[model samples]
Target: MKHYLLFAAGKDRPGIVAAISRILYRHGCNMADSTMTRIASEFAMLLIFQAPAGWRAERIGQELQRCEKRLGLFTGIKPLASSESRALKPKGRAHIISVYGADRPGIVYRVSRCLASKRINITHVSTHRTETSRAAGYVMLLEVELPSLRMAAGLNKSLGRLASGMGLHVSMRPVETAKL
Candidate 1:
């Protein structure tokens, strides 16, 4: 089997997943992993799938292109190399880091820079901005891999200092991998 990645984005609406999955089913593609969500008014999907031998990325791209108008989505497909198709295996224990603060620029930049400096690996991140008549709020959730408990302790201290300086709430907790 050959692995491929697919990305699609369009206005949010009912039947988007059904339509796309139907296409993949007809094409003999078995979805391996996928993420689909709405960001504001737009819906986006990223899927890693496997195709039967002899299937070509160009062929799938053309097929998806024909459906773009009907589906109201901009789609792209890419063939994955053998190494690129492997699943991620982080070299440390998984953790979830939470950040909440007043809406401000540079929050992600500063936080991500700190993580990079610690050599932490961020696997997933999602952030939201909330607005009300009173004020705006920011929330960020990051799934990261910490190298060790010792490193986590140092990181917690650093994050404490960062939170105190920026007037934000930052916390970290181990993810229950067994539950996952």
Candidate 2:
């Protein structure tokens, strides 16, 4: 079987999965992994599926288009290269980083740049602006993978310097993951 990555986005509504799954079922596709979420007012889905070896990517995309038309979703598909598939899994320590400050531009960019320079991989991130003391404030929660050589203290120090420069409060803590 060959693996393919599917991306779909549309207005948030019910039955999106049923529509997508029906098409996949007809095409003899098996969903191996997937994540679906609502971002803002839009619904987005990312799926990794396996199909028969001879299946053409274009044919699956056409099927997806048909499903999209029926469900009012916009869809895209790509065949994942073997190397790409291997790199998605996280390695090293998993940590959660949080930053809070008065709402302003460049908070995310600055913090992300610092992490990027250190080769830190961000697995997931969520940010929001909310009212605080009659003023707007921002909060960001980031799940990141820290390199084996860098302990939590090192990460904290780096984040602290970035936060000091940006006038933000930053905290980093290791997250314990239990295998099921």
Candidate 3:
């Protein structure tokens, strides 16, 4: 089996996923992982899948090109190296950080900088902006891997300082993982 990554983006509409998945299915591709989300007015996807060794990159590209034209999507596919196909094991405990504040610039950059300084690895991030009668509100959720429990106290303190300095609310908690 050979692994490949597919990226697709276009206007948000019904049948986008179905159209793309149909092409993969018809070509005997098995999806290993995928993320699809709508950001503002656009939809985006990242998919990792395995295909039969006989499925050449050129063949896959041609199929995707047809699908793109049919669906009016921008699509790209690339083969994954063996090393890149393997998922990265989390190096530490997982945690979720929540940030809420008035809509303003630099929120993401400032918060990410703090986490970077602590060597925390961010696994996922999602943010939303809401409008209230009084003001625009922003909410950012970050899934991160913490180096150790010992740093939790200090991390919280640091975040508290940032919250106060930036007039934002920040909170974090460990993620509960299910044991199989």
**lDDT, each prediction:** 0.89, 0.85, 0.90
Candidate 2: C-alpha lDDT: 0.85
| lDDT tens readout by residue for model 1, 1-180 | 889899999999898888888888988989988999999999999999999889877766666876688779999888898788898677889899999999888889989999999889999999999999999999999999997878988998998898778889999999985664
Better of 1 and 3 by TM-score: 1
Candidate 2 vs 3: which has more lDDT: 3
* TM-score: the better of candidates 2 and 3: 3
Q: lDDT score of model 3?
A: 0.90
RMSD of each: 1.8, 2.3, 1.8
Ranking by TM-score: 1, 3, 2
Distance from true position, residue 170, model 1, in Å?
0.7
Best by lDDT: 3
Regions of model 1 farther than 4 Å from truth:
177-180
Residues 1-180, candidate 2: write the lDDT tens digits: 788888899998899888887878888989878899998889999998888879987776777777778778999888887666554666777889999998889999988998888788899999988986788999999998877844667778988998888789999888986899
What number of backbone clashes does candidate 3 have, counting pairs of residues 3 or more apart or in separate chains? 0
Model 1 root-mean-square deviation: 1.8
